[model samples]
Target: MNTSKRLEQALKKLYTAFHHNKLNPECCKQCAVGNILDNTDNWKYLSDSHGALELNYIGKVHQALGRKFNGYTPLELLKIERVFLNACNYKLPLHYKNEKPKNPTDKDVLFNGLNEVVKFLCYLDNISNVMDYTKLFEFENDKPKYKLVFTN
Candidate 1:
């Protein structure tokens, strides 16, 4: 599969963050978009609030100028954050009264968030979801449709 340079880089960063235990839903610098943007929290300024799809004044300027951070526009970063937060069961716009996971750092919770973020990223690049494995379960005429092979 030929993935775009941006998608490849973003996926690598996300994978590293996930393995390093740096992926966090509540922290702007450790969230999905943050990791993709080199673990910087500056992307947070693109929006007035966390998980908001609307861009603030600064964000609008960047969007209008076609400025991209790590190959993603300011609005794209906000959308990525929103998708991540939503998949992690975080209430939008992150507030005190919003519903959130009791253990936000749990592996399962983070994995769920990463799964959706990856899907969204792939969607943006018009590619297949890298994390999808359901095709391995496909069967034809009571026979396994896809073979799992290990190469050394």
Candidate 2:
């Protein structure tokens, strides 16, 4: 349960943005990587397009210098945005012709995007997926095997 400082901070920011209705997949300043970067749209410059995985010239320069924004590299930010948009059901690169949810700002849609982003973040840190609860449902001999515990 020991989470890295970067992961913990990113989760807190994402949680706050989700509940406050500030998380939006379309807006570069309100998307998943945006929220984690203190709602800045500068990360958009890292990639040639919104959901592109390749780094542009500026991004490549920053990556070469080992620069990190909010503890994530420029490439990492692009990947995070791609994961969020994909989970929200939007076609890659986010164009008008791409398929997207009927309501991009809907709470449920945003929740799904957040869930996937969280999984990706955990994957980057080599930690268990925090949103997973299947372990609590484990059963042996027809009895509950694991109990859900809440901690402060």
Candidate 3:
């Protein structure tokens, strides 16, 4: 039908797949919508002492003095958050809430899907410069043992 509808269909298809067992865990996402946002630096920051470093790095945007925003990119953090939310008690699917998605064959619902994902990506790219991308996370770090500095 339309672009939005197409994306919604994609989302339902992917969600259904994940709900059942149709697609891979990481590949079925819409613009990499933070499927596994947390702990993303372990592989994404692959470089100097930071790559898989102890998550220490913060401070003024880029200059970051004593450190502040360190950790991982907003995109990465989102992935982690999504994964966590998915596992949380409140993230159950509509079907799971009322009925049950046990047989996720063609019974998937395209609620928001990729349209939501595209909007998010656009938002991210739009405000990429003014935002730290990392601060938008609920990174449950009580004390934040590590610091993450953005070399970008």
Best by TM-score: 2
Please write out the lDDT profile of model 2 over residues 60-108, one tens digit for every residue. 9999999999999998898999999999999988888989999999999
* CA shift of 111, model 1, Å: 0.5
Clashing pairs in 2: none
Q: What is the TM-score of each candidate against the true structure?
A: 0.93, 0.95, 0.25
Q: Report model 3's TM-score to 2 decimal places.
A: 0.25
Candidate 3 per-residue lDDT, tens place, 58-86, comes to: 31222233321233353333443243223
Worst 10 residues of 3 by lDDT: 44-53
User: Candidates ranked by TM-score, best first?
Assistant: 2, 1, 3
Residue-level lDDT for 88 in candidate 1: 94
Positional deviation of 73 in candidate 3, in angstroms? Answer: 0.8
Q: Model 2: which ten-residue window has the lowest total lDDT?
A: 142-151
**Relative to the true structure, how large is the alpha-carbon lDDT of every model?**
0.93, 0.93, 0.32
lDDT of 1: 0.93
